[model samples]
Target: MLTALRLLACRRAPRLPDIAPVGHVVGCLSPTLLTSLASGHAWAGRLPSSCRVRVPLGDLQCVVYSVYAPLQPSTLSSTSTGPADFDGRAFLNFGTSAQLGFLTSEPPQQPSVRDHAGIDCFPFFSPDRYVLLAASLNGGNVLAEFRPNSGRLARAANRTAVSVRDCLAAVATKPASASDPDPLISPTLLDERCGGGTQGGSVLGLRMSSCRSLGRLYRSVCLGLINNLLSLCPPAALRQAGIDRIILAGSALRRNAVLRRAAALRFDECQFQSIVLEDGGARQQPAVADGAAGLAAQFLDWVAAGRGES
Candidate 1:
């Protein structure tokens, strides 16, 4: 009887605002779309209602969408409800595939890949002006190595773990990055084959070669990953933009202590703060559904505020 009542209540719950007109739809933007936009192609498909833009990009017009629309406003930390220049925030979706982004009033016109020490970082903008970091590595695999497991995934994890540890030990003697005060523990080692600098491979190569046991690699790769992401946003840029709030989302982030620590270590300073999103007993919903729902609500609010203007 209790379950039945709960089900009924769920059904009766109010729906989010309507974004698209009847028969129109919105869905996840594919990687092809991202590639096209990066290549300066015009938008070709159905238009999303809220948090999307079709603006001029040089000679071509492009469309961009927000990836973190599923996160609720309440999940935001110390951000002003009113629009302001420095009130922007950064949201990191830590998952099997992790993503990092910044939320602001205007999406970047042209996105570029940045280099931090030896790591390559790609930044993209969502419909809501959230700039996301698109990674080439499997975040889940990294985590698998961070935690102890007893199966196939564990083996792959071990391989990456050793590489990462060796890379860290090598950089330990080098000069630290300008942004961080700690030694050079980073994910560049995991991507060694993809062009990590010689420093990452040569420094600890000899020492790590003798130590083959996975037991020696204890620190989680999450730290390196988060540190690299934060490096994308330098302190001056963050302070100038007023983006102090950090939102850490993803099932992985909620369950993993190492990931949480990584986030706290990098963001818990005077200039930056972080707030975690709690599911709070809500029924599990797909990220797409949550994002679409939020878009609908924003659309309704926009329409209402316009005095019923279309």
Candidate 2:
């Protein structure tokens, strides 16, 4: 990657002339694909069936790709140096898997790759801007499956289902339900966990306290993941970049009151406004995919007008 970047930098003596505009611009976002034959620094490569890149871009390609970050959905009118609200901004694609990043006017200085558990952090962007990004393998998909009815119910309920399992291990020993149960549990201990236990008749009551407890656990796991990612994004960097808002997107947040509450509290604590993407009369996954497609369309428009990289 470094070699390719160096080659690109050294090869160019004078700036390239403004490439003629093609018929249209090609735009895309994570988890969705759009395709076109025309190619240029301002336009993205062929779109994929999914929003993600099944084939990772080479370093040179990444450098070129960074040019598109500023053209993301919410930043259309944003100046090249910074948005009006701040010097930079962040977009958190909150989904079954989550990605958080900041848009910058320059390519990042360091190689952006790191691993926290199974999640991957890296840089993605077009030439005029960089996206400092971190992605998690865990997302709302696990939370959805964690429900008692899901096929992966056992796995989802397991302490190991989340990255913060160790943190909850000591606390999980408390019965899923008990009169003297932990505060996290509700008054009624009867729920699915009561099956085959000494409380034979408790399950008959159908008290949802146990289910609520499970939901709390899932929410905690989600919060931990988000918090961990935020911690990795240095405060100094955010302040320097003037990040004032956080835009959250994905299906994981739909019908997820707990996760949304946690995020609101955390962002408030950090003095940042949090904007939850609307459901748009659909589930979170479809809404996210549709949003990506819409953004891609706008991006293509932005590029075709010669508003992209110089």
Candidate 3:
């Protein structure tokens, strides 16, 4: 990726006249920044100074949550000349790793929090990691089966040809009744990375009717995931940073209406407005790529106006 970026910086193509040099190219490594840019919060000259953005991107191993906030003037070093100095953006990344011990039965220690350009950043851990395990236990692939078919399930609610994800969402979203009791699925999963010896995840309250119900199982998984996420970056902290809107961008939240709806319902209690990138009325396939392109365009404009010339 770096090599490709370097080549694009050094070699200017006739078709693309606004390509910035390598020195001027700003790399966006955080999902928070990407989601902020994709959601139209960041611009060439109008970067927000007092907004917070929360982004959760699901990776193969775990789900990563990135919270972006403007840099506090007090945190800036006199000699530092980094991108954060220019754009006033700083982010905290929390990865759902088993080592964090968030899923342990015992009360876990407080995650080490760092001050990053004013925003409080926490150590990495994967709270949503169990969702993947639950999917695997149910004999379904989370990435392949759940993510890909999420769009179909979200768009066409009445479609007959439902995917595994659709079925899970349907069952998960239904109101609980006497016939359907909620299952309890532990988010903890044992991994080599964990500090102490721990067992894998467990399922409880398995009734004859609910044992085979994937939705109930997944509902517990989703609740666990979202709750873990909120524990890391609570709405009170976001509001303290003057963030009223949260832009949800990621394969998991963007494609899965189930996850999106769950997240919306959960965050609604905090009174924070949420925006799903996929449901923005306009189609934004590959949102990160579009955001990167938009940033490049902004950089070109910034350079043309005697800024970002270094």
- Cα error, candidate 3, residue 289 (Å): 1.5
Q: By descending TM-score, how would the candidates be arranged?
A: 1, 2, 3
Using lDDT as the yardstick, the better of models 1 and 3 is 1
Q: What are the lDDT scores of the predictions, listed in order?
A: 0.46, 0.46, 0.40
lDDT of 3 by residue, 44-64 (tens): 335543332222223321221
User: Candidate 3: global Cα-lDDT?
Assistant: 0.40
Off by over 4 Å in 2: 1-87, 110-125, 149-212, 234-236, 277-310
TM-scores for the candidates: 0.47, 0.46, 0.46
What are the per-residue Cα lDDT tens digits for candidate 2 across 1-310?
A: 9999998998876667444322222333444223333335355664444442222223322322222323343443322344323234565555666556665555345433222222233433222434556544445554544443432454566734644333234333432333623122111222122123333111223345535454445444555656645644544455555677776655555455556665666677888787654346543332433434444564556567776432
lDDT of 1 at 192: 33
For residue 103, give model 2's deviation from the true position in Å: 0.7
> Taking the tens digit of each residue's C-alpha lDDT, what string does model 1 give over 1-310?
9999999999898779545432123454466665565464454343443334322111000111223344434322122244424246666666665555554544444233223332233322122333334342435556666554423334475564444434434433333234423333455444533344453311122234223432223232555667555555454455554557767666666665556666776787645787665457653322434554444565456566762224
User: How much does each candidate deviate from the true structure in C-alpha RMSD?
Assistant: 16.8, 14.4, 14.5
